[model samples]
Target: MADEVRQHMLECEARTWLRNGYNTPERIQELTLMIANRRGQVSAERLIEEMRRQWRRRSEWLN
Candidate 1:
């Protein structure tokens, strides 16, 4: 059940990324490495905070 939900969520997120023209496998790999490398040195909260910051800036520019 959880796995099914996870798969659906991944699909939906991938669709969103594709629509935004940022659905490259290389970008995904870089993101994976960035998260993994920071696991011991940084927290998930901090990483999400940065993502939110960037997304907000992009949204502002788009609008």
Candidate 2:
């Protein structure tokens, strides 16, 4: 449960970064590495997925 909440928070942070123009691939990779170091590879992967989902949603909303 706690881990789920932490992952949710990480997803939210990733979404915010995407909304704020930190959508570069290099920046995303950097964030993934940081999360992997602090959390784990799985968490980092989750963050990447969340960022991708948010980016897709934003693109859809815009177009």
Candidate number achieving the greatest TM-score relative to the actual structure: 2
Model 1: lDDT equals 0.50
Error of 1 at 51 (Å): 19
lDDT string, candidate 1, 20-42, tens digits: 65435576456546665867334
**Candidate 2 lDDT, tens digit per residue, 1-63?**
999998778767877778766689888888888889999999788878888887877765443
- In order, candidate lDDTs are 0.50, 0.79
Score residue 54 of candidate 2 by CA lDDT. 74
* Candidate 2 TM-score, C-alpha based: 0.67
Off by over 4 Å in 1: 23-63
Residue 38 accuracy (lDDT) in model 2: 100
